[model samples]
Target: MVDNIFKTAMRWALIFAAACLLLWVIMPEWKSVCAGLLLGVFASFLNALMLRRRVEIVGQAAGGNRRMGMGLGSRIAMVLLVAMVAYKNPETFNLPATLAASMVMPFFTLVSAFLHHKRH
Candidate 1:
């Protein structure tokens, strides 16, 4: 479990770095990297929070535990994972395009996941 989490985190960090580098040939300036990373981490946190809330609601409907127990390890792992994925494909096809693509992709993923879950 621990190894899986660490691996996932590193993988995401690499992806994040790559994406940042790709966007601006010089690699993300320190400040940009800092800001971008913060955004990524915070996004991960928000995703987790939303997920936790969702789980809590699900449990409640099912008449179970009210507390959603998302582990710290998982949260940290997600942060790292997002960072790595960005680093991996830092190359932006186009500034505006990349921005739009990035924004939509995750939402698409979420919708797909939800649909898949519902089907399951």
Candidate 2:
């Protein structure tokens, strides 16, 4: 199940990256937009990795301990880090696009989960 989620997330990220590259090639003026999208894709990938690892940790627990690996604060920090990067360089990062891109992970994850649930 987790593997499926990871694969779906990666597939979406790659698709988005490819689209971003194409957009960059077609409209060089929107380079900042592309960069922001790429950054979002990267953040999503990191989130997926952390999620996978957390699932593995729970699965491998000796008993019924339902502990999580990376806490909510750490995840929020990651989001803030991305925001900070864009905040530090609004001209280059495109704060609006960066914020939009940051949402890709959770959006796709929900989609994947819904699809998985429907299939089951």
Expressed as tens digits, the lDDT of each residue in 44-83 for candidate 1 is: 4355455556655776868755554555566556655565
Off-target runs (Cα >4 Å) in candidate 1 are 1-28, 64-120
Report the number of the highest-lDDT candidate.
Answer: 2
Residues 1-120, candidate 2: write the lDDT tens digits. 867976886798789889998998999899888888777777767866776676677777857776655555666777788888988977777777877887788788888888888999
lDDT of 2 at 89: 79
Output the TM-score of candidate 2.
0.82
**Deviation in angstroms for 17 in model 2?**
1.4
Evaluate candidate 1 by giving its C-alpha RMSD to the native, one decimal: 10.4
* Model 2 ranges off by over 4 Å: 62-70
Q: How far out, in Å, is residue 27 in model 2?
A: 0.7
Range of the 10 consecutive residues with the lowest summed lDDT in candidate 2: 66-75
